[model samples]
Target: MHAFRLTVLAGAIAAGAGMAAQAQPATPAQLAPIVVRDAPHPLDASRGDAYVATRASAALKSQADLLETAQTVNVVTRAEMERQGSTSVAQALRYTPGVIAQYGDTDVRHDWLTIRGFTPARYLDGLVLPFGARGYAQPRIETYGLERIDVLKGPASGLYGQSAPGGLIDMTSKRANGERVREIELQLGSHARRQLGFDLGGQANEAGTVSYRVTGVGRRSDTPYDHVDDDKAFLQAALAFQLSPRTRLEGTAQYQRIVSDGGGGAPALPVLGTLQPTSAGTIARSRYVGDPDYDRFTNTQTFVGYTLEHRFSEHTGFRQTARISDVDTDSRRVQIGLMASPTQAVRYAWAFPESARAFQIDNQFHTALTTGPLRHRVLAGVDYLRETAHFTESQLNILTNASGGYALFDPYAPQYGDFDIATPPDGLNIDQRRSQLGAYVQDQIEWDRLHVVLSARHDRVRLDTHSRQAAGTTTDANGDINRTTFRTGASYVFDSGVAPYVNYATSFQPVPGSTRTGAALRPTTGKQVEAGIKVQPEGSRALLTLAAFQITQDNVSAPDPQNTRFSVQTGQVRARGLELEGKASVNDSLDVSFSYALTDSEITRTNAADTVGQVGNRMAFVPRHQASVWADYTVRSGPLAGLGLGAGVRYRGSFFGDLNNTHALRPVTLVDAGIRYDLGQASARLRGMQLALNVSNLFDKTYVANCLGATGCYWGTERTAVASLRYRW
Candidate 1:
């Protein structure tokens, strides 16, 4: 029934589903606002906190043109995460482009990354941030409550639904806007790291139609290893209304708490003193393998969200979004078992405790149409999600029998007190449940400069598992899945701005446990083929993109080689890539960004007849080359006016941590620096004060950040320094 019918010409996330353009307030049958004079995109609503963002309502939910949305979208804006002082979300994506933000080692709970070669999917605003079955309950948000952070690359399950074909990461909190900001900050560096942060927004009346925002942060930290502790508490609150002109609303609440190590156990060391070198030499990057009065970790998170909008007949309208979540996790660690030589190691005491709950919802319908010269945009939707989790774990290990082994450890020379654990007999339980349902539709077309898009989606997934053992024994399991996805694209725009695009996408993932012969575990399919070229040189505010892509994934889940401890699902993987990027302001005292990437992952198929070459190898930590560049400068007038300077460089190229390709990693180059000063440009009692300094790996290099085999090696990330003081109104 394509008779839905015409006037939503501005797009606040209609079809791509980030439901936007204020997400509220539109009195019944609203119309009258459609201005297009020599417009090629650039409709209205110029970013909430501008730093050059030409729309990415999660990519084409609409404000269009990140080169007419053919895919490969990326934005990190809240002014590029405060000009790269970013503390988390993988350091604000480390200059994006085919991402790989901190893989394996320097773990800060979770935000571990990879893209273009698996593990992407994570969103919060457009839902789906659910991770079940419990593993420390995964929740860590609070990059100062976010305001931007989107990255959509390949395969999005036709419009989001059980993703991962190397793409997806949403985030975008910090709501209630019309732009009236207030800020505060206090931070102290290195390991004694201390912090306090705040952001406030306004407009609660005066015909402003109501709006409010509050963001917070508090922290006490220490972690470069030893005893492992990093503490934090965060809060968020938002509200917005404007009910009528057709209807609008917004609401939010959030809270978070974290206490480290929950078996993250400081990089979880081993590989004989980190990648072979320990004869008591090296291996001291703050070393501490658990035991400061029995090592512990805690995590707690709570969230509530809402968004609504409506319009009945200027052409058609309706929208909705909802969320609810809760989680609590606790962990105890002593972990590092087995080495027993070279420099000695053998210990274990691990314990896990968890709880979780979640709910999600999304609904939408929008329409616009034209006949003669061709123009149409349509969207349809449905979504649902549910999750639940409960967990229990305990382990204790020590070798030598006759009187017993007593957890001995000695990374060169180290010792600690109070250790004895063997707790496991409360009821010994585990329960997990999951549900998902989705439906989708989309069509966006125009024929002036020629642009076309098509979308389709369908999904159903369910999982349930239970276990109870304290001697009595009980076990139950279930899994059901179904999927359908597709996407297609084409673009051509020229007015001296250039655009050339081509796209194809598909993805689906669902693999949750079992297969050591217990069966179950199937679902992993992917596809991608892309080609791109985009540039905005007409008036030059700068935007350039160049891309090439290829990807394939199927079944995954390897290692059986005829029963080598059982595990199978017939694996296959392949990735091909090339990306080049540039973002620039180039004037008003220069600002620049650059990126480059080339990946070549392959593990084309596994089970090589037990010969163990694992079929063409290469895919752990996937990196064939990477690059980055950054620049910032401000000093408009004479005498260092409001002064600022920044610098950056990053490169990483060597990788291999498992899957039959013998370990050997060496390739690094990093440098970052920053400085700022502007006491209100020097008068009026420091109008909005500012002072800053930053440093990251500025030459304190000591490598090896991956090695997944012989005990798991890891260590990378050294120099860090920070200083700050800020104020604004």
Candidate 2:
């Protein structure tokens, strides 16, 4: 199977290259004008424009320029997302290289992602998502109201504080861009799914001083199960005011709600004796046990920011930015299923439920000073966040048949089972709060052909916990943790259009849970060493980068035997990898982008005797090899003028399920294709209207996305299709 997959991938690459060679050269008449826009602030002049704005530098530029960053950044533009008919974040990232999306169940609300071997830290316009649980689960944020999605790989701790060592994702909101626009869309598709959305944005005055945008989305759908369903709605609005020629202010507010009926399957059942058949008939009985489970998740977020720029003289100018935000989230889930059982066939039936409410406030300030022959940018900020997590559970009793199968519940019969049964006082109402105070500074030095960056930060975090039970008993816990990190890097540009750079950076993560000794474990520390080469031919439309890096972490935690849910900080791990990424626009008629990663990770030290021999094992869910390629061609002349065709393929190597490397899931390949036709009519109602169709997993491959330590697992999605239409002014 692996050999066959490789052959197919090789063939596709060859075919794409051959097609590129046969493509006709674009002439001046066929070339689209590339217009450049001014930076939001004078200090932002040094930063590259991007097609999808997310990072601090990119966010200040025009929204459409986010695709021009020099780093290995990928953007899912609104146009592409609509064309692909993406309903969720996972679906949008499917074709992005070095990104892995794993769905534990069929329901899309519980989906999660891992990028560059690290879990994603969700953000909105550079602000942290207010409510993040330990399991990487949060209230679903609808994508319908977003302008674009920006994915930044590598440590962004220089700007964003308390982040994962891997990277960060910023969801840019739709805002008024000084244009009058209004549109409505309706979609009906498989699974009895229906969706409706409307967008409004434009200037309210002739002076272009006042502008606003409002967006709303609602969806409903039924799954293949008997009682499984999904419902969601979202509304967002933004207002912008121009204070003067050199200053501006903007404010935004958003609200979202998600409700789901327990319909998807549960984690895979253990295969203790023998492997089960692959036929759908053999797996039909593996249904989600929480037949009556129901959940509601809601989020409210608001932000207000201002941008200022002034020129003290012709050679000197000052730029300043400030922003404040508030976010709140509430969630509740009522689950009815089998919690646990020694034997797989006769699991006990019960009801387990949970809820959480979180709130946060953040503020940031930045300034830039540019003088003759010297430029300095300084960033300083303070962040404070507080969250309260409440949990409750109860046990229920239900009779079963002799064959270990129970009769289905009759919805009409209210007395089929005991709905109010009490269990022991094993659960508690817990309130946890975290306060973080941080400050950072960075300086960028530019010489004749050299650029260097020096940065450092110090963060102090305090955690407090208080717990109470229904009986009025209470317990309290408190701890403080602090870490200081720094990074230095330099890039040298040559006349030959080649640039070489190297960097060394450090990161630290505070262990959330307690240790075996009842003492709070210290923060885990990590260091990364990387070197890379970048090439961009003069006046050419191509960019290439190759980087090799090694990362090591010390004081990693190992599970404590006394506490089933906690671990002791006494382990170490290391990872090394090589990455190659590039983009080429052969001309206005053709464009291609590709990325490949080779990663190896293992446990270097562990306190557990049983895990000593697993030093060479691959890390869980970390594939050794991953690659993706995308290409598109636009017809220059003929009846098919302005028509475009696109196709891409993604491949992931096999990976282990446990630290011991005892079990493995086979690798898989996914393919996507898209086509777009432009209906040109400058004055007609359909002016610049485009129609697109996309198909994913064209071969309909079946593979496992994840497994639960040989006990349970999940399978990837099957083939899917989406069609869409868009009109631009």
Candidate 3:
């Protein structure tokens, strides 16, 4: 089945490439000048408050190189993605500092990621992707469908509205660049993994009045874990039209579907034993009872949006955007546990777990205005989001006789018998509704050889929740929650290759449930102060950035002194760090990018009984040191002009899994290498053709990527290699 799917995908890519090649070519006169910068720097001048996608050539800077703006940002480029053979967003982020990917039993589905000690907030073209506890199997948006990924570290509450303090990831989609282009790629790797993708963009009409771009990807792969497999498909299309000489309009839509049949969790480990744990030792006492027969999960997502822009005059313009998105997921999994005493005779019991479903709808609108000198760039936006989660949990209480002092179950099949079990109501439902409104203004001032920018924003957010259960009718005492936050920043530039900036930002998040004493906990607050310097020397293709930051979060919560399970707002945490990043293109033959971070996070105050000495302990999963480096060398002249060699290394320091800092996980160091050969031609049936090979985890290092408190820990993958072929016109 997987082979057939791969064949069909390959055929589709080939056909798409052919169609794109047969299309008419666009003339140079129709193409616009798109700037390519050495780093991911914000627009020096105000175009609008909202971020706009620029050309990849301009945004393909190193994660560290983008830190000069006083805001922590990481940029992952398409070239890096190809060289690393990144199959998913998680894989692509491996080399990014302060980001960690936690893989479950299956490699394709069931992957989770965290950034800056918190879960990642997914975004596509600056729009948030709805999330759920049960992993959303939404087809891992293929990198081939993307031009670049920008990660803004820390609370982006000012612009993103309701969000986590962790960070935000923005995926920039491939768009029409007023140039006729076509590309097709095929990848083959271990575990029978196969993938095919295609992208095409060009002017759709004469006079450069209309343009369009389309991208598609399909993949099928089997995991090393027993009895697990995954399949995914995706498609995206965009159209742009020049309404008038000063006005432009664009519409975009994308669809994705994914299906997976696998269920796995981290294996439990001993506390005071070896530095590096092995799955072999842990699985010995663990039964590989696969999830119930009905265990499977699937996800589907669709997004559509439009943007309109108009230039009122030479120095002023206005733009407005609106979008709607929908996501649905269905999952079923059986509860499995490990036995403490494997030497004793025992029976294994199975639960008849039913299913869970999540459905979400999101709508948003944004408008911006930009004007003249001493001028103001103003932005206003609003968003409405709704989510419904439903699940059915079955209670199982049965014991079966053990054979040879051990319980055994078939890996592919498991038996469940009813023995006086109580079943819950048909469905348990939880519904959430969120509304947000925001406004911001920024000013840009120009002097002889100096430029300065000042900006501020305010946001108002509200959340409402409702739930239905069989036990009794319960209403959230907090009812409707509201919060308001503010932020400000300033940047100055000098002609001598230096730009300095400072920023003060704030964030707020509401806690869902009330405290033990029946008092509603106010929203938590986070504040940060940061300063940075950016350098771009004259006649040099290198960009360097250095930054220092201090952040504090007040009104943190902990278990109530009276009630252990109930939480109370009586904690404060602080984090201070320094970062260095740089990117350079040396004489068009070599490109290098790197970043490093040193962070110190600790609890400033805590009322919890067990958290006194833990105040100075490091935050869970936050490495004290992290760094990455990637360099690629291309043959500039000769018969091998298009050949390239790439090498990269990523390192992370040891981190604790618990707040108390008792359980520690070993650090990880990974190396990757790749080689590519491009057959270049100006204009032909296949204007460009290329072949490449990538090897990840070259040394097959064994380490844990993440842990769930004391329960268990996830392990990293071994070495893997992939080969790919590409054609472009």
Clashes of each: 11, 8, 0
lDDT to native, each model: 0.73, 0.56, 0.58
Please identify which of the two predictions, 1 or 2, would achieve the higher lDDT against the true structure: 1
Better of 2 and 3 by lDDT: 3
CA RMSD per model (angstroms): 23.9, 10.1, 7.3
Alpha-carbon TM-score of each model against the true structure: 0.32, 0.79, 0.80
Look at candidate 3 and tell me the lDDT of residue 450: 36
- Model 1 Cα RMSD, 1 decimal: 23.9
Best by lDDT: 1
Model 2: CA > 4 A from native = 1-76, 79-84, 104-107, 133-137, 223-227, 263-289, 292-374, 391-428, 467-476, 609-614, 660-662, 680-685
Candidate 3 has its poorest 10 consecutive residues by lDDT at 13-22
Model 1 poorest ten-residue lDDT run: 1-10
lDDT of 1 by residue, 1-729 (tens): 001111112111111113344332335554664323233323223333554565676755545658777877877777666766778888778877788854533666667677876778778777877565755576877787887788888888877788889888888776765457688888888888778787777776678667777777777767677767677777777677767767778777787777774344455677767667865776787787666665667777888877787878665788888889887877777766677777777776656787778898888787878879987788888888898988887535442334675556776677775545454334456788888888988887888777888988898989877767667665666788889998888888777678888899888888765565566677889999988888877655567889899989888887576665345777888999898878777776787888998989898886546476677888877778888988888897887898888888878788787768787677888887888888888887988988887877778887777777766667776888778788997
Candidate 1 has a TM-score of 0.32
